[model samples]
Target chain A: MTGKAHCYKRDHINTDEIIPARYLNMDREADLAQHAMEDIDPEFVKKINQGDFIIAGEDFGCGSSREHAVWALRGAGVRAVIADTFARIFYRNCVNNGFLAIECPGISQQVDSGDELEIDIEKGIIKNRTKGDQYTFQPITGFAREVIGAGGLLNYIAGKVV
Target chain B: MGATITEKILAAHCGRTQVNPGELINAEIDVIMCHDVTTTPAIDMLTDRGLSRVAHPERVVVIPDHFVPNKDIKSAEMVAKIRRWAKEQGIDKFYELGRHGVCHALLPEQGYVRPGITIVCGDSHTCTHGALGAFSTGIGSTDLAATLATGKLWFKVPETILFRLNGKLGKGVYAKDVILEIIRQIGVDGALYKAMEFTGELIDELSVEARMTICNMAIEAGGKSGIINPDQKTINYVEAHTAEPFKIFKSDSDAEYCRIVEINVTDLEPLVAFPHLPSNGKPVWQVGEIPVDQAYIGSCTNGRIEDLRVAAEILKNRQVAKNTRMIVVPATTNIWKQANQEGLLDIFMAAGAAVSTPTCGACLGGHMGILAAGERCISSTNRNFIGRMGSPQSEVYLASPATVAASAVAGKIADPRNYM
Candidate 1:
């Protein structure tokens, strides 16, 4: 995955902020995408284009089990989210949806907003193209890889259940 | 080494004799809960994938609590889809508007949960069932879809943390305060991907309602689940609700735990979590007169009958201050009726507070009590994330129902002990 990095040097970007619960009335991924990050950053929807990356600090997506956070980010054309750490449910949601959420320690310091990033998900390597810095992340492995290969849990379930 | 209760339960559900943390396993889902906000999305995904039928409809419980009574056009449409699907699927456990309540509280109250089993829900507080010694946890929309289609889902067995809570709580302190203190010690992600097993003296003395409140916020600490061993109290509660047969499991004396924490709640005061994080808790005395705009007591956490009793005890004969308003929401239909029977509703109304039927409204900012920019509320709900209760500038302070009642009477952050 390669994209322009939109780094937010803060931690605990909860699901409530990623996609506020008020907009949860509309579960259509497309509708939720319009309000993504509306609570934390009003300019988030306006600033980023397709194939952009969200670079964040520790404990990103900390509260709530709403998968709308992943849906909204993916729908907004975000390629991936690189955080220092992740709340477990959010990480699971991303893997289940086949959306990339990379956990790379010190990622927030290495990549600045507008920097370019090229991620080798298979190898768990992140190349900061703008800064010429490189970092490693916990690689997706085993069953999680298989689920992602099948394009999310639903497809995986469909293929298996049938 | 012996396995913890969480491990033993997961191992049993997956048909394994032993399993360790981080090992992946596919477990049979014993019970699943569906609510309005999350269920509709699951239905959409399943229908799109052409797997539109429930594999085990009998095991599924449908309750539309989040936007029930239809908050708006979109919410109404969302719930309409859930209602239609539940009928078409023939889910016998469906609870509609008049009978509906918060998902977490309703599950246990209806006897769908028991010891030594697994419970799944799309709502995070599904962990609330863990108070009954069930290995309950929350899943996302796609996960809900997959579980519905297959009756099974994969899990990465979680490490278990033993929290030995000792000492009797001080005046005005509650299970909510104990949990807040735990979260304060271990930040938001302290138990990431782990199971929190709360045990020892305090849990033994605590009522199931308070235990549910503690387990409900397990998600706030990033836990996979929060659990306790089923004792006589659990069996009694379960029997009172249903005649269903249930197996029981306990952690072996030599059970393995990844970590152990010793908490002494002897003189702990009423606690409150400030804006933006549940882990940002401090003693209410230190909060010093932060004016409250709204004091809310509801949600799966503290909307139980016991919680209502506590709030009513404090709010009795006390009028809500002119500067703030209080909203009391009993968690389930039964809880509401019980509170009404006990005259708690009358006290709230006579005390100049608003009482409503059970809904997760205002807690998630869906509707009913949204705050304007810069407004603040003291809530008995679990979270305090930014804009969690309303506008981005509106802050939410999380406290026990007792503290919320006291703060509502005082119109600011005040010590509940004074009322006690």
Candidate 2:
């Protein structure tokens, strides 16, 4: 999978902002997808295309361990989220739901918006296709990587256990 | 080499002799949990992945606490999905509306948590269970799904920062105040992604309920989890609730802590976290005569029996402010029953306070007592983020139950000690 890493350098991107509690009533992916990031930036839904990424500062997804945050990101066409750090809950939610959330220390500073990039998660390297910059990250465990590789924990578990 | 309590527990559970912070380690999880607000999506994702049965049914817990009694059709449908999923999965433990309180409170009370065990849930407040000496923390839906399927989790163990409290809390001061004070000193990002191990004389003086209150808010400080070593109070609490003996573990005197924060509680007065931030705390008096449109005393943070007692005692022989509305909700049915049996409910009712059924109502601005535009309310719940309690224009002031109850009577924010 390849995409231009569309980076937004913001921190404390809580679950509430990812998918506001108001739209939690809607469960369908399409309906919920339209409201993604409506709380944080009203126009975020209109700003990006599929396969874009988000790079954030510290404590991303800091409040409310709601999985909707991951769902909203996945639904919004975000393929991966590279951040300096993530709230434990948010990080796990991403992998469980099949979205790629990578923790690369100082990743927020390595790139800016419009900086074309290729994230080879399996190789544990983020190739800045635009600047020809390559950064190595602490790869998730084989199991976690496999889970995300298979499109999330549920999908991974289905293949392995079911 | 000596290990912090967090490191030791992770090592013991994961079967490693020693583990270092920031190293990827996949540890076995004893319990995996999710609740209403998050569980429906989790179940959907789990099913979409084609899982038929949980790897360990008994180890997985699903509670529908957030929107119980169904405020709207959407919430009802979400809960309906969970109910059907629970039944089909043969899930033995499912708490319905009245049966559910907060997931954090219900887990320990039902003996699902024990010390030295590693627990993960889909709610940040899952750290509350760590008060039992377990390594409990919150995980996201993606992680919860993996845990449900494999019954294991990968983690880079976090380093710990120790917080030692000394001296006794002064009148009307409480664990909520202590936590707020700590957050004030450390700022919101103070312990980002770190564990907080609380030790010291003041902890010994606190009841287990009070300690749970302290640990419950540890997440607000940006810590992975906050825990106190199990002592007599902790043991007694476990004993009173469970027939099964739980293993107790304590931090070695020689354990290494990254940094230790020492706090003297003797001089503390009542504290309040103003709207939009948990750490925006100041002495109750420092807030000076702040008026309130409402007062609320409930939530996972400070909704226990003792919390109720404190509020009820202060409300007796008084009435809520003529212009202000006050709502008192028991955290659980058991706490509600105990208050009824002890006549605490009478005090609340006689004081012109509206007593509601146990729900997470208005804590996240999901239901009853939601503030109208430009309104302000003093609450015993955690979090005061903008629009957290209702409209973005509305404000929430976080305080202990005593302060909420006392303020309910005075029709403005007032210190509980003044009335006590």
Candidate 3:
């Protein structure tokens, strides 16, 4: 997947900032998309096109176990999130939701906003097209690879049960 | 390679002789906790997939917190859907309005949580159950739905980080202060993807309720769970609640630990975490006079009866400041009843504090006591993240319930020691 980067160089971009608690009451795709990242960046949704990626520092998606944050990002045309690290639950949420969360340590320092990123899922390599840089993330292996491969836990479980 | 308490519990659940950190295993769940916000989504996902069967109705407990009492039309519908699903599944442990409370508190109060069990919930604070020596952690909706259908979930055996806390706690220092100080010492994410095993003289001396407070915020330090080996206090507490059978798992003295931290608690003052992060904790004396508009006490973190008693001790004769409003929410209906019988409610209301039925609202900025822009609240609940309590411009300072009461009386952040 290829997308432009929305680089946020600070750490701890919590789920609350991604989607505030007030919007938690409404889970519709449109409603969540309408207010995604309103707490941190008011123009986040308007500024990104479909298939764009978010670049963040450490502890990205910290605080709150709300999966609505994932829905809000997906709804707002976020294709994936590349962070130095992620809060544990948020990382699993991405895997279970079939959303991409690439952990590229120090990736925040290497890229600027609006830079182009192309990810090769098979090789676990992220190429910075604009800067001609390459960073490697932990290749998804074992059961996790299969879960995402099967398009999330629900479908994976359905297949296993059947 | 001896196993820690967490490993012992997970190994038992997965039918293995032993398991190591970083290994993945599919473990059978002994308890599944469901609440309104996330359970509604899990239910919808299940129904959408034609997989609406509960693997074990008897093992699930449904509690509608977060937006309990229906904060709005949307929340009311979510609760209704959960009610319909619970009824259809024949899950008798569903605690409807008036009977419901925070899942972490209500589950233990009713004796669903016990030592040496694997527990899963859709809320982040499910780690709160680890206080009783259970291997509990939070999951997102997809995992919740899968667990609900199969009574099993996947887990990566987390490395254990041993925290040895020793020394006597001075007057006015509570478990909440201890956890806050620890979080400050270890920046957030210090223990990422690890099980925090707390032991030593201080943990042995603490009451079960106090221990719960200490274990509740393990996530703030990026721990998958926080646990203490079951002791006499744990056994007595469980025996008082129910006769259900439970196992006791203890870590071997030679267990492998990824890291170890030692904390000395002597003369430690009460603490308050400043805005933006739980790791931004400061000793109450070090914090300047920051005025607060709201003082809230409740959540899975510190909403137990003992927490209410601590706040009541400071608010017995004092009044909430003119500009500051106080809200006290007992974590469970049983706790609410116990507080009322003990006259804690009367003391709170007479002191101009509003008493609420159990709800996680306001703590997560859901409802009941949300703050306005430019407002600050001194809360006993965990996490002071940005926009956690209301408007993004609002600030939440996290402190002990006693400290919250004292601050409410002073109309700014104040030490609880002075009031005592």
- lDDT (Cα, tens digit) per residue for candidate 3, span B102-129: 8888998999889999999998888888
Model 1 chain B worst lDDT run, 10 consecutive residues? B63-72
Q: Which residue segments of model 1 deviate by more than 4 Å?
A: none
| Model 3 clashing residue pairs (backbone) | none
lDDT of 1 by residue, B290-311 (tens): 9999999999999999999999
Off by over 4 Å in 3: none
Model 2 ranges off by over 4 Å: A1-10, A53-56, A79-84, A102-147, A158-162
TM-score for each predicted model, relative to the true structure: 0.99, 0.90, 0.99
lDDT of 1 at A51: 94
Indicate which candidate wins on DockQ.
1
lDDT of 2 by residue, B1-420 (tens): 678878888888788888888877878998887687777766766776676467788887777777776889999998898888888888878887767877787788777877778899878888887787889887776677667777887777888899999999988999999999998898666787788888899988888778889888888877888888888777778877878756676788888777889999999989999967788998988787788999999988988899999999999999998999999989888888899999999999999999988887788888888889899999999888767777767889999999999898888889899999
Better of 1 and 2 by TM-score: 1
TM-score of each model's chain B? 0.99, 0.98, 0.99
Error in Å for residue B309 of model 2: 1.0
DockQ of each: 0.85, 0.51, 0.84
